[model samples]
Target: MHFGIRFYLLASLLIGAATATLYFFKGHLYSRAEPLPLEKLVLATPRIPFSSLVILAKHNNLFAKHGLEVQLEITATGKEALEMTLAGKADIAAVATLPLAYIVTRSAQPRILAVIAKSNYEHSVVARRDRGISQPADLQDKTIGFLPGTSAQFYLEALLTNANLARNKVHMKSITIQDSQSALLSGDVDAVALFAPWDKRAAQALGESGIVFAPSLHTTHWTLTSNQNFPITRPRVAEKLLLALLDALTLIGENHEASLDILAQEMEMSRADLDESWEQYTFDVQLPQALITTLERELLWIRSHGNVPSGELTPVAPLPDFLDYLSFSALQSVKPSAVRITR
Candidate 1:
C-alpha cells in the first residue's frame, strides 16, 4: 500500500508539471495567433459622389484589409472637410481644387496627397425663371446664392466669366447647402451656384422654373489632402491609405454596378439619382499637371478678389510653388504611373 501511494503521488506531480507546461505553451501560442492591432485613421470627406472611392474603401473593408481602422468624418462640403483636417480633427481630408487653393494661398501647411477624382460639369447654376434669369447672360443684376469659400463660389465666377458678365454685376449671397433649396424656392435669392447633388436637388425642386447652367470652365479635381506633417510622420499610414484607395479604384473600374451600389448607399441617394450624375465623375488616382494649372488659375482668382468670402481684404502674398503643396512620394511609391505631375 505504501508503494502504491508513492506511485500515485509521483503520477500526480507529473500530471501537474505537464499541465503547467501545456498552459505555458498554450499562452504563447494564443498570443502568436492574435492579430496585430490595426492602425487608426480619421478621414474627413464630404458626403458626395466625389468621395466615392474612400467611401467604397470603408464599405468594402479595404482599409482593414490593409491593416487600418479608418473612421470617416462626413462633412457637408469639401471646404468643411479641409477645415477639419487643418484644425487637427482629421488625419486626412478630401477637398476640391478651389478651397484647397484658397487655403494653400494662405498657408503651405496643407499637403495634397492625391487627386482622386475630377469633374468638369459637377457644378451648375440654378436660376429662377421668374427672376428674369433665362440665360447666364441675364444673371447680371441678380442676387446669386452660393456656399462661401467653396468651389461653388469659384464656379459661379467662372459661369459669370463665361457669360461676359462682370463679377460686381450680380449680388452674391452666402448660403449653406442645407438652405439652398428653401432659399431658392422662397425667392430669397434669384439664383444659386451649387455642386451636385445640391444642384440636382435645387433643379428638381424648381421643376419647370429652374434652369441649370453648367460651369464647364475647368475640371474640379477632388483631392486627398492632409496636414504637412501627417505624411512626413506617418508615411506608412499614408501609403496604406493610398493602397486602399487604389483597391477601391480597381473595384470601381472593374465593376460599375457594384460600385454604384456602394456609392448610392454611402451618399444616401437613390441609385437612379446617383446614376444621373455618374457619368460626370471620372474616378481615378492621379496627380496630373492639370491639378497644378487649376490651382494656379484658382490662386489668380483668389488674388484678384483680394479677399476670400470669409472677410475683409488682406494684402495677398505671392503664390507659393504649388508643387510644394503636393506630396508625390506616397503616390509614386504605390503606383508610379498615377503620378503624372511635371515635377
Candidate 2:
C-alpha cells in the first residue's frame, strides 16, 4: 500500500509539471503568432530644423511604440508640405503659422494639430557688406530677395517696418529660399531674407562679407497640421502621433547632445550649425493663445500685401474665423495641460 501511494504522488507531480509547461509554451506561441499590427500614418514635413521632433520620433521608433507606423514625406518647404496635406497626399504636415494663416484664407480644409516649436531668430536678413547694407536702414533702395507668399516676405516686410523703412523703399526680388544662397553669391540680389539653415548657409558662404540681421519681427510658430476631417475620423491615430511627439520632446529635453545629433543627421546639417541654432528654438507641444493672436496679426499682413490672389477671396470678404480652423480635441485628450487655447 505504501509503495502504491508513493507512486501515485510521483505521477501526479509529473502531470502537474507537464501541464504547467504546456500552458506557458502555448501562451508564448500565441503571442508570437498574432502580434498586434501597427497603424500606418503618413506625415509630410519640411526638411528643416523645425522638424527635429518628427525626425527624432522616426529615428527612435516612438511612433511604433505607440502602435503607429509613420512614413515621412519630406518637402523643400513647409508650404509644400502643407499643400501635400491639403491635396490628401499626406495625413499630416509640419508647417509654420505664416503659411497656415495664408492657406486658411483660401481653403478652410487645414486644421492646426499642435504648435511644436517657436523661434524668434528663425528668419533673418543675410546681406553682403560690399553692398553698403550694414544697417537695417541701409536696406533702403537695396534689392532684397524673398520668396513671395511665404514667411520670408512677411519677415522682410516686418524687418523694414521695424526699421521705419517703407515697403516701396526696397526693391523686392522673388527668389526661392533654395536659391537664396546662389542668388546672393551671384549678385542676383543685394540681400536675401530667409529661414534657417539657409540663412546660416548664406552667412557662411559670404564669410567676412556676410552680415546677418535678425530683427524682432514676430515669433515663428512651427505647427503640425491636418485636414478638417482627419482628427474627427481617426482620433486615436491623431492622439497616438501626439503621444509619440511628446516622447520625442521628453527625450530632447533630457539629452540635448543626442537630440542634436539626430537632428543634424536628419537635416543633413553640420552638428556645429545645429548646435549653434538650437538655443534659438523652444521645442514643446502646446496650442498657445498666442497662436490665435499670431494668426490674426498675420492675416492683416496677408490682406494688406495682397498675398492671396483676388480670385480666391473678394476684397470685402471678412477674414476667416481663425478659431474655426483650429482642432484642439486630439491634443486635449492626449495631454490636457498642453492645450492653452481658451476655446
Candidate 3:
C-alpha cells in the first residue's frame, strides 16, 4: 500500500509540472508578439468634461492592449498642452487644432497626425437672461469676455467677423476660462465666450440668463500632434491612436446616456446638465474638407491681426492633401465588430 501511494504521489507531481509549463508557454505566445519597454508614454489632456471618453479609455486598459502606455496630464487648456509638445516637454498633446495649427504655422515642424474630433456647436457666446442678448450680431459694441488664443476665441471672432463686426466694435477682454464664469455671473462682462460644461454651468446659474448663438462657427476639436523631429515616428502610431479614439466615439454615440453618465462623473457635473449638453453636441470622427476651409478662414484672420505676417511666412504647413490625413487604412485595421456597439 505504501509503494502504491508513493507511485500516485509521483504521478501527480509530474502532471502538475507539465500543466505549469503549458500555461507559461501559452501566455508567452500571446504576449511576446510585441513586448514593449517598461516605460510609459505620457499624453497631455485638458480637464474639460467632454474629455472623459479619452480618460476612460486609458483607465479601461484599451491602450495597454495595443502595446501603449498612456499617461494623462490635466492641463489648463489645450493650448497649454500644445506648448508642452512644442517645447519637447510632452510626448503628445490632445487639444484644439487651432493652437496646434498656429504652432505649426509659426514653425513648420510639428506634424498633426490625426484629428481627435471636429468641433460642433460647442463654442458659444452666452449671456444672462437679464442681459437680453439674443444673437451673435447682438454682441456688437458689448463687452465680450473671451480667453484669447483659445478655440473659443477663434469661434467668437469668426462669428463676430462674419456678422460684419470688427474686433474693435466690441470691448473684448481676455480672461482665463475658469474666471469667465464669475465674470459673467457678477456682470463683470456683458457676455462670456465659452464651450460646454462651462456653457451648461453658466446657463444653469443664471436661469434664462443664457442664450447661445447657433451656426456661428465650428473648427477641429482635438488633434494629436507629434514632433516631426522624433526619430521613431511612424504613421502606424497615428493610425492606432485614431482607432482607439474612434472606438470610444463609437461607444459614446451608441450609448449616449451611459457615456453621459461617465462624462458627468469624470467632469463632476450633475446628470441633468450632462444630458442637456449632450442634446446640443455632436461628435463625429470623420475628417472633411470643411476643416481646411476653416483653417484658411482662421489663417486669414491671423494675418489680419498681424499674428503672422502674410507675405513673410505661410500661415499653415503644406500638409498631406485633406484626404491624406484621413486614415481609411487605420479605420480598416480595426475590425468593425471589435468596438461596434450597434452596427
Please tell me which predicted candidate would have the highest TM-score against the true structure: 1
Q: What tens digits encode model 3's per-residue C-alpha lDDT throughout 11-111?
A: 99999999999999999888977666633566787866546557656755666656566778778788888778778788777777666556555654665
Candidate 2 accuracy as TM-score: 0.88
Kindly indicate the candidate among 2 and 3 with the higher TM-score. 2
Backbone atom clashes (below 3 Å) for every candidate: 0, 0, 2
TM-score of each: 0.89, 0.88, 0.74
- Clash pairs detected, candidate 2: none
- Candidate 1 lDDT by residue in tens digits, 76-179: 99999999999999999999988887777666489999999999888999999988878899999999998888988888988898999988898988999899
Clashing pairs in 3: 128-209, 129-209
How well does candidate 1 match the true structure, expressed as C-alpha RMSD? 5.3
Kindly report which residue stretches of model 3 are placed more than 4 angstroms away from their true locations once superposed. 1-39, 49-52, 129-135, 230-239, 253-256, 279-287, 307-343
Q: Is 1 or 2 the stronger prediction by TM-score?
A: 1
Per lDDT, the best of the predicted structures is: 1
lDDT value, residue 324 of candidate 1: 88
At residue 295, give the lDDT of candidate 1: 89
